[model samples]
Target: MDLRAGLSQQQSLKLSMTQELSQAIALLQYSAIELVDFLENKALENPLLHIKSRKAEVYQPKAKGQSQKSNDKAWIEQISDQRFTLADHLFPQIQDMKMSPFQKRVVTHYIYHLDDNGYFTGNLQDIANHFNFSLADAEECLAILQRVEPAGIGARTLRECLLLQLNRQEVKNELAERIVSEHFSMFAEKKWKQLSKLLSIDIKEIQQVFDYILTLNPKPGAAFHYERASYVIPDVMVVQEGDQFVVRLFDHILPKIQFNKDYFASLNSYQDKKVNDFLNEKQQDYHWIIRSLEQRQKTILNVTGKIVDKQQAYFEKGPTFLKPMTMKEISEELGIHESTVSRAVREKYVQTPFGTVELKSFFTNAIESVSDESLSSSKVKMAMEKLIKEENKQKPLSDLDIVQLLKENDGIVVSRRTVAKYRDQLGIPSSSKRKRYD
Candidate 1:
C-alpha cells in the first residue's frame, strides 16, 4: 500500500436538508392551530404574504321566560378565568372569626403553607420560631385550621386526614375510627387476615369499613384548585358517502393565505440593487411557505385516507374491530418514511362515525394468538375489561386466572405478567384489593 496526498473522486447520493425542506417537515408535524400560529408569525416577516380569516359560527341561545333567566346565561359565555385557590378559600373564613389577632395570623400563615393536597407541610418548630410562639400554640392553630369546613384540610398524613373526616361525621363509625386511628397501616396494606385476627372482628366488617372510607375525600382542597375543562379540535373528518369513506380537511377552521400581489409589484422596479434583492428574497420566502403549506395539507390528507382505508372495519363496527397495524406498515403501503407517517399523526385527531378519535389509537401492537392474524392489544384489553366486569367479587380473578380466561373465551394468548400490565393500564386493582365479602 502507498500513502499519498491526492484528491479522489467518488460518486455518492445523500439528502441535503435545505431550509425549505426543513420547513416542509415542520409544517407536516404541526397541528391545525399550530400551523395557523406559525403562518401568522411568518406573515410579519414576509411582506408578500397575507393571511385571510375564516368566518366563525356563533351559537345563538333560545328565548326563555323571565323566571328562567336566572338559571340560564343570556347569549355569550364567560371566557376569563378567576379561579380561587385553596388559600383564598380559607383566608376569609378565619378573617371574620372571633379569635385573637396573633392566633388568626398564625392560622393564616399555616393556610398559606398548606400543599395542594391540603397537607400542612410546615414543621411545628419552624412555625414556632417564625411567630415567636410555643410549639403547643402552633399545634392549636393547626387544629383550628383542620376543623374548618373542608374537614381534612390541614392533616399531615392520610391516616390523620381520614380521622379528621370521620370526626366531622354526624353519626360516628366507631370501628372505622379505631381502625383508621390504630391499624391504618394494616388496613391500607390489605392485610385483612391479620386485621381480622388483631381486631377480633369479622372480615366482613372490615370490608364495610373499607367501603365507607372510600366515600371520604383524600385531597380535600383539590376541589378548590380544579383545572378548567379543555376542548379538542380535530383536524380532519372521515364521512361515509354511499359505501366509500371520504377524508375531508376541516377547511373552515383553517386560516387561508393569499399573496400580497400589489405589495410585491409596487416594491419591484426599484433601481437600487439592495431594494431589488430584498424584494426578490421576500417573494421567494413567501412562495416557499405557500408551497410548504400545500405539501403539508396533501401529506396529511394522504396519510389519513390510507388510515381510514386500512381501519375500515373499525369505522364500520367500532373500536372492537381495530386490527393490529403499525406505522411501519402504513409507511410501506403509502411509500413514505416511517417518521413521516408518525409526524403526520402526532397529536392529530380525525372525526369519524364513532366519534373524534386520536390518530395514534388506530395503530396498536399485535397480541399473540393461535389464529393466523393476531389481535390488537386494544381489542384484547377490551375483552379483559369485560371479563373483570362480570367477575365474581367473592373471588376476583387473579392475573393467572385472567390469562386463562382470555385464552378460553377470546382465543388470545398472553402471559400472566402481560395480563397484570393490562389490568394496571385499565386502572383495575389486584384480586386481594378487589375482593368483596358482602
Candidate 2:
C-alpha cells in the first residue's frame, strides 16, 4: 500500500445517478404503451422535448442482412389521439337547446356517469337527485344525448339502449321489440326453450331473434373513434427463419441523438460564469435524453425476446396454445422486478405469423381444480359457460347446481361463490333471472 502525493488514486465501483435514470427508462420502455401517455404529458410540460409519432421503418431493429420488407399484414391500430367520448359528441348539440345553465350542468353530470358503452349505470332519479334537478328534466337531457351520433348513448340499461335505437328505426316487429325489451335476460342466458314457450313463438323464430341481437354494437361510442388514427409499434420482432426463432429490435428509425454540436460550439463563446454553467447544465440534459432513449430500446428488446422464448408455443400455434403466464415468471427469468415486467408489456402489441396481439393477453391466471392441477381461469370460465349453454332451459342450473355439476362431472370442486364469480365473469345471469315458466 503506497500513499502518493494525492490521497491514493484507487479505483472504486458505485451505482451512478444515471443508473437510476437507466432504470426509469427501462420501466418506461417496458410499459411504453402506458408510459408513452405520461411521456406525452411530460413533453407538453418540457419546452425542449416532444413525442414523435411512431414510424413504420422504426418498428424493426437495425441488423446486417435483415429483412427491410414492408409487412402487408393488416393490424388493428389503436386510436390513440383525442377520442371523442359521449360527452364531447353530445354536449355541443345541447348548447342551442332551450335549457338553463343549471340544467346543462345536470346533463353534464349524467354524461360523466356513462360507461365506455355509452350507457348510464345510475338511474335517472339518482342523477337528478345528485344535481337537485327535476326527474323529468334529467330524463329529457338523457333523451337528447341518446339521440346523438351513437344511436344509444345515455340509456339506463342495455335493453333500453337497444329498444331506443330500434324505436328510431321504425321497425314494426312487435315480437322482436318485446323480446329485446323484456326477455333480454333469457336470450343472454341462452334459455331458448323458455323464451320460445313464453312468447308462443317457434324455436326457429326465437333463434333468428337471438342472431339479430348479436349484430347490435354493445359499445357504440367506440365506433366513433377512427380505426387508423394511431398504433403500438412493437419494440422487438421474433422472426422464424427456417426452424429457428431469432429475436431483435427495430432501431433504424430511432434518430441516433447526441448533445447538439452547435450548442456545444456556442458554449466556448460565452465568458460569463453563469452563462457557462447554464450551457453545461443543458449539455447534461441533452446527454441524459440520448442515454435514456438508448436504454429504453435495449430493455424493450431484452424483455420482448424473453417473452417470445417463453411464449414459443403461442407463436408456433395460436391463441389457444397460449400458456398461463404471469409478470412473476418474466421478472424471475430476466432478474428484474415484477412491476418492471408489467410496465414492459403494458399497451404493447407484437406482430406475429398468427396475428398481432396485445402482450398482456398472453398472461392468464390459473384456477386450482380438485385434482390440484391448475387450469387457466379463462378455460374454467369457458367450461362453465359451455355447461350453462347445454343446461336445460326450463330449469337453468343455479350456482349451487353448477358447483355440484363441476364437482361430479368436470372434477372441479369450486365453491358456490366461486361458481357465481365465474358465472358473472362469463356474463351469465342467475337462475332466478334466467328462468321462465310457460
Candidate 3:
C-alpha cells in the first residue's frame, strides 16, 4: 500500500454546463406557445433583442352570393360563441315563481351557491349567518330552489340528486329509489352479490338497476356549463405528396427576432466603458438566442422528418397503422443523444393529413410476437379493445382469457398482467365489474 499525500494535475474530458448551453437545452423543449412567451420575456431584459410575433390565420368562409371585397369582415367580429349557461337557465325559473321579495332574495342566494354539478356546495350555517336567519330557514330556501324544472338542480349529494329526479317522475322507480337511498355504497362499488342478498332481489334486477343508473348524469349541470373552445397550434406540419410525406416546421407561428440596430448604435457611441460592456454583453445574448432558435427549429425539423418517415403508414391510413418506435431508436438514427430527441418531441404536436396529434404519441412500446418479431403495443391495445367490445357480456372474458385469445387469434403472446395493464390503460373495467346478468 502506497500511503502518500501528493498533488498532481489530471486532465479528463467533461462537458461544461454553461449558461448559454442551459438556455439552448431549455429552448429545445419549449412548445410553440411557451417559446413565444420565453422570447417576449427575454426581449424585455435584453435591449439588443426585439420580438415580432405572427398571428395565426383565421378561416373566412366563402359568402354564398356576395363578392369577396363586400363579404370581407373583421376576424374578431366573425368569432362568436353564444352559449346558454346554467345561470341563464336558472335565473328565468327563479323569476317565474311568485314569492315574497325577501324569500326570492334568499332563493337567489341559494342559487348562487350551487356548483357546476348542480350540487349545493355552500355552507348552510354561513348562509344563515349572512342572512340573519336560522339554518332551518336557509334550508327551506334551498328546498324551494330545488322544486324547479331540473329535478336534481339543487341536491347536496349524488344520492339526493338521483332520489330527487326519481321522485319527480310520475311512474316512480321504487327499487332505484331504495337502492340509491340505502345500498348506495354497495351498488356504486359493484358489490352486486351483497346488494342482491340485502335487497332480496335477483342479480339480473340489480344489473337492470345498474344499467339505469348509468343513464343518469353525475354532473347534471355540466351540460349547461359552456366554455370557449381551445385551439391547438402545431409545431410541425406533414403533407402527403402522392405516396411520400413531406415534413415542414411551422416556425412562422413563432415570433421572429430582430436586432435593435438603432438602440445598439446609440448606446455604442458612448465613451463610458460600463455602457459599452453592457451593450456588448446584450449583443452576445441576442446572437446566442438567434443561434439557439435556429438550432431548435433544425432539430425539430429533423426529428419530425424522421417520425414522418417511420410513421408513413400511419399518416396514410390512420393510428391503426402506427408502427412500434422509440426515442432511443430515433436518437441512434439521428446520431444524437436520446435526451435531445426526447426534449425535441416533448410538448410538441405534428399536424398530419388525418389530424394533429402529440409528437410523443408516435412512439409506441413494442411487444414480442410469437414469430420472434416485435408488435406495437398500440396494435395490441386495439385488438384488445375489439375483443372486449365483441365478447359475451354475461360471462365477460378475464385477463388470462384475453391473453390466451391474443396468443391464439393474434399470434401475440402477452402475460395476463400485461393484459390487465393494457385494459386499465384503455379505461376498461375488470371482468367481474364488466360482467352483467342481463
TM-score of each: 0.88, 0.56, 0.91
Q: lDDT at 189 for candidate 1?
A: 88
Model 3 bad stretches (over 4 Å)? 1-13, 58-79, 98-103
Per-residue lDDT of model 1, residues 1-438, tens digit only: 778889999999999999888888888899878888898898898888898878676654455654566436543355567788888788888977777989998998888788888998999998899889899998899888888878999999999999999999999999999999999999998999899999899999999999999999999988887677977788899999999999988767677788898987877856888989998898889888878877777888999999988889998999899999999998999999999999999989999999999998899999999777889999999999999999999999999999998998888999999999988999999999889988
Q: Which is the better candidate, 2 or 3, if ranked by TM-score?
A: 3
Per-residue lDDT tens digits for candidate 2, residues 158-207, read: 78877877776656666678888888888867677788888887877876
- Tens-digit lDDT track for model 3 on 1-438? 978998899999999999999999999999988998999999999978998888767766676877776666555477776888777888899898888788899888887888887888989999899989999988888888888867788999998898888788887788988999988988888999988898789999998888887777677788888767778889999998887889988877788789999999998889999999999899999999989988998999999999888887898899888889999999999999999999999999999988999999999898878887678999999999999999999899999999999999998888999999999999999999999898
Candidate number of the best TM-score:
3
Looking at model 2, report the run of 10 residues with the lowest lDDT sum: 70-79
**Candidate 1 C-alpha error for residue 216, in Å:** 1.1
Give residue 225's error in model 1 in angstroms: 3.8
